[model samples]
Target chain A: MNVLPRRQFIGQCCAAVGATGMMSALSALRATAAAASIPSGNNLPGTEADVASDYRALVCIFLNGGNDASNLIVPYDASGYAAYASARTALALPQSTLLPILPKTSDGRSFALHPSTGELKNLFEGGKLAILANVGTLVEPTTVAQYKAQSVKLPPQLFSHNDQQAQWQSSIPDQPFKTGWGGRMADLVNSLNTNSAVSMSMTLNGVNSFQVGNLISQLSVQPASASSPKGGPVAFARTTGGNNPNRYQTQKDLFTSPQSNLFSSAFGTLSSNAIGNSDALAAALAATGTIATSFPDTSLGNQLKSIAYLISAAGTLKLKRQVFFARIGGWDTHADQVEADVSLGAHAGLLQQVSQAMNAFYNATIELGCANQVTTFTASDFGRTFTSNGDGSDHGWGGHHLVLGGAVKGGDIYGRMPSPVVNGPDDTGLGRWIPTTSVDEYGATLARWFGVSDTNLPVAFPNIGRFAKPNLGFLG
Target chain B: MKPATIYLAVAAGFLLLLLVLRPDAGVATDPRSPRIAAPPAPPASAAPALAASPVASEERSPLADGLNAPAGTVDEDLRIVATLIEVFRSNFPRDGNPTGSNAEITAALTGRNRLRLALVPPDHPALNARGELCDRWGTPFFFHSESRVQTEIRSAGPDRKHWTEDDVVTKQ
Candidate 1:
């Protein structure tokens, strides 16, 4: 009997208002609207209270500082290994140390995971994780010859850190950064929720470029800490007290006040909504039972635990759809790529953290019984140079990424794998590769599975039309 | 002479003739050989002259651009320009930030011969019309001297536009 102590129980009560409170608020509001629209005399079909029956979530795990993915997914076959080693020089992983995985496509070409990727290997072998090869920001479908010739327009800011990361989320590198695909998707489908005031997109990280939309800004929350406003109605949003009810009511009035200025009015409305959402979500999470799966104490692990709590509360909150964002930084390994033994270093540590955290998150989804309804994917700024600059590699384009869920077609690699040919057909010169698969194709596939219609797919991904295949077919 | 002795002598003479002639060597005069000559080696000409350098030119000259290209290519002409830029940046003040003018910085180098040899290479393009260091697309590299310990170096990228998507700047 593992009994939660009194202080620990109080701490859990304080932490009950998890990340996706805004989604729940919106759902509640939408359900209210549906109920209101029904006529008193004539009994029309009222708002379906069970909209939560078809709950789904999309989680985007962004690896900051441009994760060097050339080493993440490696070639295991003899000929492939030789080419990779020759090109990478000192930075290549030893063939003997790699963890080989049986890919579905057995064309005499096999691949192995990074030595630190044992957890991810288990997920792959268990048919729950799929690898998307050589994917990156692209304006249109580009060929090697066209890229070299500059015949087709290329993605903007090919290697700049901020710009490339922005493009990975925004999908329009040439233009300015204002909105991201996640926010756009939320804008397109958020109306389906009965609640209109709360946004469907939520972030554990503070503010980000990924969830910025024209109309719907994502709700922000800290995974381990409360919102902790300096002095607002939401500061004690989830707290129940009657000592100074006037101060709380005064703050609430300030939040709901309609200022003459447009911006002030909007801010007031948003503040009021935040307070309302905090109170409701706190009650719902308090009533929800604990999850059986335990996550690590790492930052990403804590973020995933918070997301699991939010997913479990989906039924209570009446949320039909949701998108959550979580991230971890410091993957930029320009120095000290590995120790002399070639076993552990900064990059390997990041890989191990990602593997363990993702594995645990998947287990949590299964525990919640929504494993098939939710999907998780990885995104990065860009791949790193295959060539080593003595100690480490430089920033590059076109990287391999991971897609994991129960609905994913696992044990396979989607898209064309770029040949590890430095200065050969695939390389530009210093081991930077042009992506064979575009971001449009990747995002469209995920959006399609998220219940987006073909016609409205462009709302989420504007340039989806340029690519021939919007869906990459990884989803079931 | 006996018939056997005559036949052995004839065979020996034929072997010696074959060795001396060497018909398979593929000399043009040997009618039995193929007509074409061997493939040419990659040209490694000396750097172009100083006066003809792009820095001295009235108009910006366009060179090839492959600064960020991957390896395994035979026709990448712009790598030399990128390599030279890397070397030039390495020659900055010890603290990695330079406040002095280009001439002052060039003179302060401890190793003068290394800079002199690289500053002017024959047949090596990448000199803009202003005779300054630029990328293959004629985009000039700007050296902003704001900080005392560090100077900003950036190249106007492929579109010949400044501060756009294709700009390549030094890591701060």
Candidate 2:
């Protein structure tokens, strides 16, 4: 019984035309090409589309602004915690507020999450959360002295935003490139799609480096409250006045009339497209009902709601394989640690939202009878320093991340956590700890689980061979 | 005027406007060409010793061709160099366009450190020598500069101001 907002309804009309029209255009182009060529019968294979309607997917939640991983995964063991406590003088999380995690082997080695991650604890206990420790970008295995002396060939711009972002997404830090690991995966497997309405890749966040590819563009989804464009064709299509044999009359009138040049005839077409897509997606979403699973009420929570709604309408979309991108930021605490956490109230709340929403989403899949088919993971630019800069923390490397899904060998920590020692041999003079694990290893593992062949892995992540293990041993 | 005449006049006017805007569309194609011609020579105030700053000796300077580089090739090089410079601003969030994929690059090229290259002439030794430097960086160092000038990488030297005359690893 709830009606969409007036502004939203209009925006939906615009978005519909934009996305659906483009998709239809691309599909038509593809169809023409397909008809011209003989069927290999081996069309684009390996997408969620190729498999059973009940399949799993991987959702990557990237926390921008270099989340302070030092605080997220604290050293819980006696000697390790002491080393952490001493090095992180002002930046240490209190022992009381910590959520203790006891690893399988209690060789007295453990860690704790910040008090803000209560939902994360529940998920971890429920065997849904798996921690990935101390991962970062690396051209090759590098040492601190080598880093300072510049002896090793490293990622082009270390500690750089644009380059690192591209590097993280492309897995090629050295040059301008095409497509991300996920996009490449979709390229390999999108043949299984039933219809062309939904893209294999979906980004709740706007267009990002990770979701862009030479041939693939991420289907951008705005939050529920945000307006989506409308779809379909000309307004007043049913009614026609006078002799309509010639279209010149309307064209003449439009051209002669003075209007906002910025928002002109061309914009009208663009708006129409946007609205078209919004209407299609919205209409598709309405068939979805109160999901049994509950999502958090935060921004990410709302995003998850939309994701769930879309997933509920997956049959309508005719999608087989789907990849989604979403995240929560504000972890850049450089001023007040306590106040930063407070200010990052939305962010902390977002994490809970992610955990709850993901759980709900997973349940919805199970309800749809597709539990083992969906996977979710988290990533960031880099980890924050263990030591706080008085009020907050500074950017550092080798932070912890998490991956969750039914397919993941959940309830365990992967990768080695460095000893939190300031200016130690492992430390790069600053709090930046050398990463034992590379993003290549992490991405390769996910790609492999997503059905990427070992041969295609290097093509997806060129630098994956430089690492000791192509597989991170986390996914089955 | 008759309606047909009005329509004809409007259509003609619109066609003229389209033709006028045609050049404007091309303007978006290459933005660095103007900066390269004048070489906004970073105001003398910032790097006071820039004039006295050591220029590589003829033997050490690969780009002794003067100021000019090949035509469209120079512009291409400028685009790549501009991308590289913008990469530096990525780490400094305070001075960065911490948003999406392309916006960050645009923001980095806006202020004082915005990219520029000066083309001297085809025969300039600096321009000719720059060919070697361009090959080394995997692209031309500066657009329009006969002597290809460029910011040094770690191999050239850590100082961001310096440029290398030779690719040392290939020297042997």
Number of the top candidate by DockQ?
A: 2
lDDT computed for candidate 2: 0.54
- Model 1 spans with C-alpha error above 4 angstroms: A1-53, A225-250, A253-269, B1-56, B59-172
Model 1: per-residue Cα lDDT over A1-476, one tens digit each: 11133233222222212222344334333322232222223321111222255777899999987788888888888999999999888888988889999988765778899999899999999999999998999877776766654556666435556667889999876566667888777767777665543346667765567776655556554474333211011133322444366767887798687799987886566455545555555444444566667677777877777777767755555567888889999776666777656558888888988999899989988877778888999999888888875667767788999999989998899987788888777776567777888888998899888888899998888888888889899998
lDDT of 1 at A120: 97
Q: Candidate 2, which CAPRI tier?
A: incorrect
Docking quality category of candidate 1 according to DockQ thresholds: incorrect
Instruction: List, residue by residue over B54-146, the lDDT tens digit for candidate 1.
Output: 122111112123333344121232333323333334433222332222222322221122122223232234443434445556555544433
lDDT of 2 by residue, A1-476 (tens): 12344344333222222333455334322321221122223333222333365444678787776777787778877777888878777666567667898654443568887777776777677776788888888778777776654456666444444456566777775555455777677666566665655466666765566755444456556655434221111122211343343553454354345567655754444433433444454455554444566555666666665665566555555566777777666665554445434325433444555556667666655665555677788888777666654455655667788887667777778887776678777676447777888888998898887767898888778888889989988787
- Chain A only: give the TM-score of model 1: 0.83
* Candidate 2: regions farther than 4 A off: A1-54, A105-108, A226-278, A339-357, B1-172
Error of 1 at B169 (Å): 13
User: Candidates' lDDT values, in order?
Assistant: 0.62, 0.54
Please give each candidate's TM-score: 0.67, 0.61
